[model samples]
Target chain A: MRSFVALFRKELRSYFGSPPFYFVATAFLAYAGYYFHSDLIYFITFGFGLNIMENFWQILFVDLRLVLIFAVPLLTMRLLAEERRLGTLELLLTYPLRDGAIVAAKLGACLVVVATLLAGTLVYPLLVYHVEPFAFEPLFAAYLGLLLFAGVCASYGLFISSLTDSQVLAGFLTALPLLLLWLLSWNEAAAASGTLPVVRAISLFNHFQPFSVGVIDLRDVFYFLYATGLFVWATLRVLEARQWRGRR
Target chain B: MIRSELLTKYYGSVRAVGGVSFSVGAGEVAALLGPNGAGKSTVMRLLTGYVSPTAGRALVGDVDVAERPVTARRQIGYLPEQVSLYPEFTVRRYLGFVGEVKGLARRRRRAAIGRVIEQCGLGEVADRHNGTLSKGYRQRVGLAQALLGDPAVLVLDEPTVGLDPVQAVEMRELIRTLAGCTVLLSTHNLTEASALCSRVIILSHGSLVAADTAAELGRRLEGAGRLVVRIDGPPDAVAQGLSALPGVLGIERGEPDGQAGVRFVVLASNPEPVQRRLAAMAVAAGWTLLEVQVKPPTLEDLFVRLVGSEP
Candidate 1:
């Protein structure tokens, strides 16, 4: 447990010590804030009388998803890929370090980065509060939605990083899968045909929809939890295989 | 303290190391000498637990590398052919990380890092990033990393391959100081083995072709017998006199001057007859036989015999 903590702190220090953390987080947060306000103003001019839940749902769908979907790949591509390219992975592996510790710390540090980005968006709710002191239940749900979405994406990115040493390849590979999921449920003809239930279930939109509304549905949370678990398990498997491959 | 029994390693149907068996005890430095692809690195990897053997067991302190890998790994410090380090990290940070991974306690880890830096001559570049250092400094840092936690055994693959002549000499001196720590380092540098190792293991085509002390290796590879004789007699007279004698194959004389003037590298079928002839000549020539010691074979002769003479 102590070794785990030591490794985690070392990982976090590496992230903070490099340029990627500060720039990536700040840029994602600023873009999300700008787009959410723009999205809100555009909806208002259309005379859309969105209540607290409706406004939160609208911000959640367009703003958070757009920024997070793009930002996640940038934040996580280097987690394992850079270690491999630079041969530091061997340095870590040759030590008394456990594979679980390495995977946990990498995912945890990315989550922390995601947490900082989510924190920056708190200004959105404060701005919304000035217009009316209505209940902000839906916005709170949206924040939870944001956390789960970021966590799930980060895990997927880490799994992809395990597959290749090139960070650019990892980013592209990760984003392409998420982009496909985002579009999976939207192909109107497939829904009409009622085929490909697997594709429909795998889509990120279908699972994230309930949270966009004022509902913290257990089912949607479970979907994100399962997504996070499956990829993290895959990440662990890949890391474990490295030892086998290295052994003559 | 270290042993490998019939250890073999394969890279997908191609055997890099055949069934090679050898052992090294504490207070001894053994050199694994081989040409390229002679399985020197493969053997080192198997012993270090960096790679599991395809068959057989490698025991470091009675911990079988394939059976109890972590324990085996903990007892050995390995420096691979390439000094693979975290380039972005300074030498100190890299060692600290290595210390933690090697399971050293915090206080002892610090002390060990400090001691290894001084021991490997890495104090000058302790704060510099490992990537930016020169080849000699980088090799020292790699050696420093290997020396961490004071592992009982060190497995260094080509530790001095990239150094300039002077640095190679210095690196050899450092390796000599590590005599108490069981070392099995492979090098093309015969001079290194000549100066440091007590027993040298020669591998050819992944087999134990020769295992002996530096001088023994020299003698065995010399075919029949050869001796370098220095006497206080005339060079031309000695060369001509020795050539006329039976079993005296050749004699190449050095420049003459005073008592130590006449010297030559001698080749003969049998060294005993040459010794007798030299003793008789010393008495008859009215000159003293100052030095009549047998010179061991040169490294080139050893390489030809051990690696194969056809090349």
Candidate 2:
């Protein structure tokens, strides 16, 4: 537990001490904030009889997810890749800590950064609330969904990062599959009618849609958790394999 | 405090470390001397629990590294050859992180960090970022990281590879001050091994070729001292006379002395007697004795002879 905390704190420090974290956070907030402003104007002008907060937040959450698809990879690419490239991973593995602890600490740190970025988007909700009050349940559900989605993305990104020492390559590889999953349901003609439902079922977009509408389904939550676990497990395996395969 | 029983590691078909075994008693300093790719780093990695051996076991302080890696690692402080550090972290913060990973309590971590900082002479640059420090300071910081938690075993791989002369000496001095710690450090430098280690383990082709004190290895391998004699006489006549002298095992022609003299290397069990006899023979033969110097076998000589003879 102590080793985990120490590694967690160190990962946090590395995130805050470097330029990429600030760059990604700033870019994500700016992009999310710009869409939130435009979505607010669209809500004010065209939204009638609709719950302004629900519709506004749902749109904003979707926009933030889009930005995160790209931003999260940038954030997670260096987590393991940089360590391997710098030869610090060997030093880290030698410490009195389990490989799982190391992986959890890094993923935890990345989640914290992602959560902070999601927190920045709260200003949009606060601004909307002053004009008209709204239910907080859906808003909370939406934020949870976004955090879970980002967590899934981060786990996969970390797993990819563990495969190579090139951060750019890791980022590119992570984004490619995530982008495909997000776009899986977009093309109705790409799949046969019988296969379309199965494709939509696995799409990250379809799973996150229920949360946007203020619905917290256990299946969606479980799906995100299971995917995150799958990739986290894969990463642990890669780390363990280094001992047998020999660390470069 | 540290032992490896037939520890072997294979990276696919290529064997990085064969079935090799050695032990270092508590409070002893041993040196792993080998040329590049002799499995020195691999052996250290196996002992530190950074990598598992394919066969046999590594033990640190009664704990098997493969069975209880974290527990075994808790008793080891390792400094790898490439001193990798987070460039953004200050030396103090880095050491603090290392202490934390070592499971030191907060207050104890602070004390250990401070002690290592003082011990490694890192107080001057404690607040400086690691990337901005010089190579010497980086090496010192790596050592300081290893010194934290005061582990029973210290495995340092090429601890002073890139440092300047002064920094290397300072690093050696710092390592020398680590009393009561079983230290196993690897180096290509025989001088470093001779200076800092009481026992030298020489590896050739991933196998232990020799493991003993430097002086003992010399005595066992070479058996006697060597003498270099320069005489102003016929080369063949000088060689014939030197080979006939008592106590001389063999004689070989050495490089010319630039002056009008021939040089010959005389291998003898007892060099003082051979030196005197050669000088007397030079005088009797009316040959001027240019120089006659006894050359004690160094770790380098033993290392070269051992490593060079490996298939």
Candidate 3:
């Protein structure tokens, strides 16, 4: 447990020390802020209501998800890949650490970085409330949804990062799967009746839809948790496989 | 207390490290001497638990590295050949991180970091970023990290590969100060090995060709000391006379040493009497005897002989 904390602290320090964290953070905030302003304009033009907060939460959640698809990959591309490239992965393995602890530390630290970026978007909602007041319940649910989605994306990106030593390749490969999932739900309404439900079930955006509308569905929550677990597990396996290969 | 028995590793079909084994007692400094690709690094990796042996076992103290890597790693401090470091981390921060990961108590961590900073002569660069330091300083940082928790065994791979002559000497001196530390350093530098390590283990083509104290390996590999006699006499007659001397085993002609004397390398198990006899023969023949120097076997000679004899 101490090692985990130590590794976590190291991970966090590394993130803040590098330029990529600030670069991705700045880009995420700028992109989300632009969409937030546009969402605010639409909200003002459309006027406020009991449903205004729900719509606002949905817009914020969707824009945040879009920003994360790019941001998370950039943020996580170096989690393991950079370590491997720098040959520090071998050094880390020599430490008295369970591979799982190393993976968990990286995941935990990256989640914090992502959460900070998401937290910056909180100002948008606070600003909206001054001009047009709304309930907090839906906003809470939507933020929870965003956190879950970002963790899932971050884990997926981490898994990709563990697959190679090239940060560029990790980013590219991570974006590929995320874009596919995002596109799957994009045209869900026009999909064939037979495949529409299945497509929506697997689509990341669809899992966040209930929270966006102020309804906390257990099934959607479980899906994100399970997906995050799956990716984190996969990342651990990749790390273990690296050991097996390195031993030879 | 480090040992490996018949340790072997193969990357697919290419054997990186063949069945090789050696042990270093507690507080003893042993060197893994070999050429590039001769498995010095691989052997270090195996003992340090950076990798597992495919065919054999490594024991750090009583812990089996393959069976209990974490516990075994706890007893070992490793500095790989590359000296990998986080570029953005200052020397102090990096050492602190290593201390934390090694599970040192807060007070101990701070004290150990301080001690190592002084030990490795890294006081000046403690606040400097790792990437900004010179190669010699960077290697020092790597050494400092390895020394952080004061583990039972220190495994260093080519600890002085890229340093200038002065820095290399200083690095050797620094390692020498670790008098009671069990060190297993792999290096291609024979002088470094002879200067710092009491025991030398030579690896060639992934197999340990020899392992012994430097003096013993030198004497054993290069059988006998020889005397080089520079005599101003006819080559054939000088060779015949040198061969007939009571202590002379054989004599081989050498190029003249610019002073107009044909040189002969007289091989003899005992060079003391042979040197005296050759001088007397040159005097009896009225030939000028310029030089008769006995050349003792050296670690350099042993290294070249052993490494060259490999198929």
> Where does candidate 3 stray beyond 4 Å?
A44-50, A130-133, A188-201, B215-219, B226-294, B309-311
**What's the DockQ for every one of the candidates?**
0.23, 0.68, 0.51
TM-score of each: 0.79, 0.88, 0.85
Deviating ranges (above 4 Å) for candidate 2: A51-54, A190-198, B227-292, B309-311
Q: Pick the candidate with the highest lDDT.
A: 2
- On TM-score, the candidate that comes out on top is 2
Write model 2 residue lDDT over B1-311, tens digit each, in one string.
88888989998888988888888889989999888889999999999888889998999989999999999999999999999999988999999889989999999999999999999998899999898999999999999999899899999999989888999999999999998999999998888988999888988888888887666787774656778778998888888888899987666687765777998777777788778888899999989998888898666656656776321
lDDT of each structure? 0.77, 0.88, 0.84
Model 3 pairs whose backbones collide? none
By lDDT, is 2 or 3 better? 2
TM-score of chain A of each: 0.90, 0.95, 0.93
Poorest 10 consecutive residues by lDDT, candidate 1 chain A: A239-248
Candidate 1 clash pair list: A96-B101
Provide the DockQ value for model 3: 0.51
lDDT of 3 by residue, A1-248 (tens): 77789999989888887787888888888999888888867766785554785556677678778888999899889999999898888889989998889999999999999888888888987876787666777888888888899889999999999989999999999999898778777766667899888877788898888888777899999999999999999998887664446531
Q: Provide the TM-score, chain A, model 2.
A: 0.95
What shift in Å separates residue A207 of candidate 3 from its native position after superposition?
A: 2.3
